[model samples]
Target chain A: MNKIEVCFSPELIHLHELQGKIVVVVDIFRATTTMVAALANGIEEISTFADLEECRRMKSQGFLIGGERNGQTVSGFDLGNSPVAFIKNEYSGQKLAMTTTNGTLAISKSANADEILIGAFPNLSATIAYIQKHRKDVLIHCAGWKGRFNLEDSLYAGALVKSLESSHEADEDGALAMKSLFEKEGHQLKGYLGQASHAKRLQNHGIEADIDFCLTLDLYDIVGKVENEKVKAVIKP
Target chain B: MNKIEVCFSPELIHLHELQGKIVVVVDIFRATTTMVAALANGIEEISTFADLEECRRMKSQGFLIGGERNGQTVSGFDLGNSPVAFIKNEYSGQKLAMTTTNGTLAISKSANADEILIGAFPNLSATIAYIQKHRKDVLIHCAGWKGRFNLEDSLYAGALVKSLESSHEADEDGALAMKSLFEKEGHQLKGYLGQASHAKRLQNHGIEADIDFCLTLDLYDIVGKVENEKVKAVIKP
Candidate 1:
């Protein structure tokens, strides 16, 4: 079996080190969560851009622009970084040029990875299934807040390790810590993360709904994989 | 009440933003723990430097040269990065120049902070006392492993918040998460961090004794303060 590793916040900074590994990009607070929901709810291919201008240029190419800034929708973009906005019927069979605060930046950093798959609670099972089938060393890349570690992202990483712990070995200390934290607190989401800084920030924003949406398990059977700077669903064999 | 923030890691990247905060540097695995233990056991002052050559130069200036690498004592040094080494009559009345994987880097980055104090479980109470007396906005900086977010450091940050919850306000999600984690598992050091990647790495290296030593509480009362590219103890009133 290929080794599966988890990269916490600091490891994510040197993301190029995982160039040879199959990568799973996770930003559960919004980016990956939105992507998982979009794909699961039947939206077609999503292209990502690091710069707003690049995404804007794609708008002229008939792509729907999607992204956000500091937790709010960017003006003139067709879709925001909200799961609700991404799950609409009108977005069906469409191309989405997406960007966000952290997740897209992570995807950009891991451009050298042999494969990049979006992982979130909603698509947890499908993501694990893909990892098992590939049997390649996996690098779980958490999109930390502003290139720093955040609570929600690390917890999601721990949650993933809990799902695939039987066959994977965590190479870094961060991976081991999150995995243990998960093993202890997997059953109690709110209680485990109630005093977390991000949870408080979310509560302050009155966006309790997003937090609930981000934590839903295995809601998406589809896998979001990156190809040519866009994330397209893999049609399961 | 000055704002109290938590820096998730000790990477140089965040140094630009932490320029004005009062930083509490935590490296429980060894560095800060060692510093606290050294001072509590009657070592006069601990001086820190990033480069070994500089430490040597400082030693020529009648200071003790001490440091470590990959959790082992540096070859030809006066001492290693363990608190156990500093607890002796040999270190009294002598200055010390030291470097380590994480703590030194954090102290260097914190050069711009209004003030910097070394913190760890070994001197948790004194650290809190220093911060309370200083009455400044504090930033708990976790000197993570090799520029990444290490769990032990975050846990230490949480431990601080857990101890001082009533007197502090967590301004960000990162702070709240750490406080929550600490509240949940701070007391049981081994139980809480036994599976951490670094701890496991140490166990693999037959250095398990250091983990227990690093986690001991109130072992020292010395406070480390930063001054012109080095850290030395501030004489308490």
Candidate 2:
């Protein structure tokens, strides 16, 4: 069994030390939530960019510009960080150029990982299945707010760890902490997650429904993987 | 009221942005714990260094070399990273050069902060008193285990946030999370910290008693501050 470890923040990872591990990118606050919802509702592949200029450059190449800043849609972008914005049927089969506060930052940081998978409560099962088949050491990359630790990301990581407990070891403190936190509140994710800073922020901003929606587990089986600058739905061989 | 933020991992700090804040360095695993214990037991001063060579040079200057690596005392060092070792009455009035896994790293990282104070449970009240007097803005730096997040550090941060909740705004996600965690377990720090990876490791290594000792609040009233490369006792004036 391969030992999977969870890193609570991207800064915890030394890229060179992770040469062979399969990395899971998690931004539960909204990025991965937005991604899963976009794909589950029929959007095509999503291309990511570390910088807004790069994402803008790709929009002319048949990509729909989408992303957010401080939880709102960028003025000219096609979509924002809201999962609600991603659910309209108009986006079916169109490529998305997505940028987010914490999610894209983490993706950019994990550019050198052997493989990257998007893990969110919405797509938990598919993510687990993919990891089990790959049989590679996994690193759960929590896209913390800016360079700091965020609770939503860590809770999602805890959920993943709880699901994959048989196949992974808690190598780092983040991993162990997640496991313990999970044991303490796994049965009531939404209640525990209510304490999350982003969740409270979103709620205070009058987006309480989004938090409820984001906490829905295994709502979609869509598996998104980063390949050549875009995250595509992986068709399992 | 000023906003107080606590970051358990140095990686969580955006040092460039924290230029004018009053920062507290907490490394309960050994560094801050030893600092508080030493000062309380009468060590005259404690100097910290990131480089072993600098520490070695100081040791030759009649300073006691006190530090550890991988949980063991460094070979040839006069003392290791144990709070017990620092509390020994035999070491009263001595000068010490210390280096450890996380605490010194945090101090070095705070090179740009307006001022830095060491926060450990033993000196929690004194640290809070220093914060009250210097209330420009406070950032607690949790010296995590070698650039990785450790539960004990975060819990210690929570203890600090719980102490100053009435006078500060929890600004960022990391700070808010620390505050939430503190509110949840500040009273049972040892029990709360028992779930951390470092605590488990220390427990497995038969040092659980040290973990308990380190979590005890207000054992000493000394505030440790790093000035001129040495951690010296400071009064709240």
The best candidate in terms of DockQ: 2
lDDT of 2 by residue, B105-189 (tens): 7888887888988888888888888788777788888888777777788777767777788777775656666665566566677
lDDT of 1 by residue, A137-202 (tens): 778888876666666787888887777777777756666666766766678776666566666766
Q: Across residues A1-237, which tens digit of lDDT does each residue of candidate 2 receive?
A: 787677777777672256788989998878888888888777778876667777777778988887666666677777666787766667788878887757887888888889988877888898999888888888899888766678888878877887888887765666766766676667888887887777888887778878888888877777988888677778521
TM-score of each: 0.88, 0.85
Q: Against the unseen true structure, what C-alpha lDDT does each candidate score?
A: 0.74, 0.77
* Stretches of model 1 off by over 4 angstroms after superposition: A1-4, A9-11, A69-76, A86-88, A183-208, B12-20, B69-75, B200-206, B228-230, B235-237
Candidate 2 lDDT at A32 equals: 82
Q: Per-residue CA lDDT of candidate 1, range B6-122, in tens? A: 775665336335656678888887878777766666566777766777776776777778887766777878888767776664576666777775788887777767888888777
Q: What is the lDDT of candidate 1?
A: 0.74
Q: Which 10-residue window of candidate 2 chain B scores lowest in summed lDDT?
A: B8-17
